[model samples]
Target: MPTEETQTRTGEAPRRPRIRLDQPLTPRRKLIPDYDPEAFGRMSERIARFLGTGRFIVWMTVIIIAWVAWNVAAPDALRFDTYPFIFLTLMLSLQASYAAPLILLAQNRQDDRDRVNLEQDRKQNERSIADTEYLSREVAALRIGLGEVATRDWIRSELQDLLKELEEQQRSVAKGEVFPGDGDRGRDVDDR
Candidate 1:
């Protein structure tokens, strides 16, 4: 018998599977290494907090004043960024640029945390409301069920009614209107 592969291919060699050469085989590496996003966010928050403090402002002012004094008083050869203080201005601007984004990032993270906390609080409030309503319903059901049950006052009233009827029956028997051994025959004899 002919081989199965030769029979199907009519003596032609088996075809190789097609490959997609246009696409990359492996993922490309990033220029910078990956870092923990949460850590970065926390760092940005700390930086933003420090930037907002009065201490930071005081230190920055002192440094700028010292820089200006040095540049103005120092000899020409030693001076850097003289009269206009262009370098100092540029450094402040750069710090401000970086500060703005870090502060905004921290605020966004805080907002996200607040949103999650609010959602959790809302769910807890809903659960509390549901529990309160369930308890209220249970209490109402118990009240209604207890209304149908006999209580001490109700038992006392029923016993008092039975005692009054027995007293009336005893009075009739003492007047000879009824006898213990007979039913209506005693009343009939009395009538006769």
Candidate 2:
């Protein structure tokens, strides 16, 4: 136990000493409990937001409309991409190249955001734990101080005084001391 000296200021009660906050993190302090992803309820929300983007909708629509128009309107000579559809195949390959990377980029951004949020949560938990530990230490110190000042000596004195008074009363009763009375007095019938 580390002990320190303290004194009262004017008429105020004496202060209990305490350790400084600049000290390193200790196991006694804890903020948030263990984190569980299922308990956080955030995975579904992120997926929904990604699926609803305008860019995804636009790209899908353009691909479908272009395929239909090319089949219906192009004559044999006008069809630059014929039965084998070499040009159409190249166009699809180009789109896939860009689309696949864009999807990956979006996923990477989401992962970064999740990492940042998790770090924030962890710091908040640490602060909470430190605060809880500080409060517990202060409360324990107060209890110790109270115990020292509110001693049992006064209670013991009071009990002793009561016992002396009871002994005096018992002596008086044993002496058969009584005041004179009209022993022959009788009650009248129907007296209110």
Name the top lDDT candidate: 1
The TM-scores of all predictions, comma-separated, are: 0.78, 0.46
Candidate 1 segments exceeding 4 Å error: 1-28, 181-192
**lDDT: worst 10-residue window of model 2:** 178-187
**Model 1: per-residue Cα lDDT at residue 83:** 89
Clashing pairs in 2: 30-129, 31-129
What is the model-wide C-alpha lDDT for candidate 1?
A: 0.88
Which digits, one per residue and each the tens of the lDDT, describe model 1 over residues 71-100?
A: 999999999898899999999999989999
Q: What is the lDDT of residue 25 in candidate 2?
A: 56
The positional error of residue 163 in candidate 2, measured at the CA in angstroms, is: 9.4
Q: Residue-wise lDDT of candidate 2 within 1-192, one digit each (tens)?
A: 322233332445555666678987567855867776543335544544554689768977897567757765887666555556567778878877865655565566678899999999999999999999999999999998988774688788888888886665555445533112311232222231
For candidate 1, the TM-score is: 0.78
